[model samples]
Target chain A: MAIKDLPRDEYLLKGHAACPGCPITVALRIALKALGNKTILVIPACCSSVIQALYPKSGFNVPILNIAFEAAAAGASGVSAALKKLDKTDITPVVWAGDGGSYDIGIQALSGALERGTNFIYICYNNQMYSNTGIQRSGATPYGAWTTTTWTGKKEHQKELGEIVRAHHIPYVATATISYPEDLYAKVLKAKNMKGPRYIEIFAPCPPGWRFDMSKTIEMARLAVETGAWILYEEIDGQFAFTSYSKKILEGRDRKPIEEWLQLQGRFRHLTEDDMKKINSHLDEKWNQYKKS
Target chain B: MKTAISLPTLGAMGKTGTWRVFRPIIDVEKCIKCWRCWIFCPDGVISRDDYPTIDLEYCKGCGICAHECPVDAIKMEREKK
Candidate 1:
């Protein structure tokens, strides 16, 4: 469906506390449009909590339960159970969190909820660092990227949270990015209709954390996919298939050099040629796996 | 005991227009009205009719609309201090 075909309802209201050109807000706007009014958000301690603004003045039209940093999935599970008890199956319990909340602190709770077959949507809008807490490196922070804690660069590669969740063999799991709104919307809408645990990780490029021009957020995200730095795919039950531009990349559409993506972000300015080689080899290995899959 | 809860309201943190260094000006004559600007806007400030109308009161001058526009229909002009 086309962009105009999407619902015109505005669940994410205007003039929130989000910074100018925040990718999280952009992704949320599209996801909320798909989710519609019968949705309750379970937000943890992330920029989204701040983006929702202070008490007595919310930026979102939907009800949101702001929980602790590590309790997003657990809180969502409780909300899902309560909704089930009330026979309010129409309402969706969505956990909107960041990398710090998902790949790091909340993984245990998330694993528990998924294992229990909790009916909820867990979305990790991974900006690759603890952006809300001043750009510290997190488990999802990519190798050779600078953060407050990683002054030189992060020594380890990012945690494969999607693969970890996929191990649960949940009903729905997808990787999306802010650049492709339609793909993101479609995935969220599909996950909304299905039962059991759903996980979608959106590659959100932070303007401040990634150190790019605020307006270039979409460009940065697009470059990520174009460079094979990020792959977009969906796994339903046991089946898997690449989607959108990533589908093209899998079918021999040449990937642009990762440097095209890296040079744009200030966080990667310190990455040496040796580091670049490591990053390229890692990407090759990932694409090789994708090809084999 | 006090509780923290927010009611849905526009401009939750006061006017964001002042935060803008640049303001987007749509060239109505050149407009294609594709709705890219309307969808990509983080604040949900742009409304679509035949053409798009931006709500400058809450628009943070992100320039995303200008950057994402397929055509050069939108321009980012410096906001007057």
Candidate 2:
């Protein structure tokens, strides 16, 4: 869909506490536009939890249940069950979590929920680290990206949270970014229509955490997709297909050099030539895995 | 605007304008009225009327509206003392 075709209904109201140019806010806005008012958001200890603001004053137009740090998925599952009991199945229960909550802390609960075929949408707005908690490194933090815990750069590669969730043989799993709102919106709509566990891990960039100019959030997100650092694809009932942008990359379209993406962020400013090459190869490996899948 | 214990009423109740370091000023003559700034504003402070109107009461002056304006219709000016 064209950018102009996106719905203008503001489910995520303005005056939110999110940082200027915050991608998580953007993601939530776009996703909620697609989900509509009949949705209950279950957010854990993440930026959204704080961004949603202190209780008695919320940034969200929809009902949001703030849960424990490691209980987003579990909390969502309970909400979903309650909806079932109340015969309010039309109301979509969504787990909006951060990478810190989903990839590391809440994985066990998420895995169990997915295994039980919980009917809900689990969206991990991955800023690559524990951004809300002061940029501490999380499992989703990419290689060669500096964080408070990883002063030099995170040595290990980002964990494949999508693949791990897909392993549960859920109804749907997808990867997206705020840059591609049409695709993200479409995926959320599709997930909302289907029953069973659905997961979409969005590559949301944190300006303060990633040390990038706040205004460059969209540019940075677009560059990540164009460089193939973050692949956009959906897996449905074990069938994998690359979405719009990633499909082009998979179809022999040359991606922009990884440096174009890396240089835009301060986190990678400390990297040497060899370090960039290492990251490039790591990206290549990841792309190859997606191509094979 | 009834107050209930449910959810905080929408609109700029906090008067977040106090948080502004830079305030956005729109040039009506230059504005195409594309609503990009209105749509992209995180605070939803920009009104989609005949001309874009910023409700400064809630506008935190993030400069997003100015930054996203394609026609350069909006400019971020430093907040006065």
Candidate 3:
């Protein structure tokens, strides 16, 4: 269904503080369409929080609950349970925040919510760093990436937040992006229908944070999926299924080197040919093991 | 086969979290001015004249139009699907 006809409902409107071409903005629009106007949005201190001004003076179309930076998940869970107790189970609770909030400070809250299978959706809009805090490095920052904390160049150490989320064995967990509206919208609709906590990590490119052309936000997201950098998959009941990640890049089994993908972004510009080989080999090995195990 | 890549560019963030492909298609009929595909295209491959045109020449097929199309005009046809 076209996003427009999806509904005339307004959950998130324009004229916000998000950077130009911010994928998160698009993601919010699509997500809202799927969620309809029946959701209560939970946000933390991230770019999204900035998208709307302080409470009572915001630009979104639904009610906003701005919680602590590390309590998005926990807070959302509370709302979900509270809604059930009040017999308002029709309302869907969404914990929407940035990577830093989810993978770092909020990890504990997220874990707690997942364990109990909170009846809400936990969405991590991963822009890859603590973008709101002056580009500080977060656990989600990629290898060889250069964030404020990893100024010298991040060593080969980046955590797989999606894999970790799936490990919870939640009923629904998927990686989506603003670039693919249908897939993203469809996933949101699917998650909305399912009960319990659902985790969807979306790649929301930040222009000022990532050091790329403002116009290439969606391009950047596409590159992430095209290359083996991002693997779109989901885990249900322990058996995982890939959604968009091509097996071609799987294990570097039958694909080209990773250099083609890295060269497009300035963050990896400092790496030498040898560094690329190391990165490629590492990714290749990881993919192989990921598929095997 | 030429395109512009201006330097000093502050590229956006990539999930690098997965590998996926999303391609865009045009309905030609359902597509009305709107200019969404032309205005929001990250690659600038969409035509600017009257209607939206996909320059397969340089299109990486990210399916932004399909995602952003106000009407259900654009659709994502997975290369493999």
**In candidate 2, which residue pairs get closer than 3 Å at backbone N, Cα or C atoms, i.e. clash?**
A14-B43, A15-B43
lDDT tens digits, residues A89-113, model 2?
8999999999999999999999999
Candidate 2 scores a C-alpha RMSD against the true structure in Å of 3.0
Model 2 ranges off by over 4 Å: B1-6, B11-13, B28-35
Per residue, candidate 1 scores C-alpha lDDT tens digits across A67-133 of 9999999999999999999999999999999999999999999999999999999999999989998
Q: By the lDDT metric, which is better: model 1 or model 3?
A: 1
CA lDDT, every model vs. true structure: 0.93, 0.85, 0.72
The digit string of per-residue lDDT tens for model 2 on B1-81 reads 964433755642466778788888899999876766765666667766789899887787667677677899999899899
Q: Report the C-alpha lDDT of model 1 over B1-81, residue by residue, as the tens digit.
A: 977778999889899888999999999999877788888898889998878999999999989999999988999999776
Off by over 4 Å in 3: A1-10, A54-56, A245-257, B1-81
Model 1 pairs in collision: none
Among all candidates shown, the one with the greatest TM-score: 1
- TM-score for chain B of each model, two decimals: 0.91, 0.85, 0.66
Ranking by DockQ: 1, 2, 3
Candidate 2 local distance difference test against the native: 0.85
Chain A TM-score per candidate?
0.99, 0.98, 0.92
DockQ of 3: 0.04
Q: Which tens-of-lDDT digit does each residue in A29-125 have in candidate 3?
A: 7788789888899999998777664433565667778889999998998899899999998899999899999998999999999999889999898
TM-score of candidate 3 on Cα atoms, chains taken together: 0.77
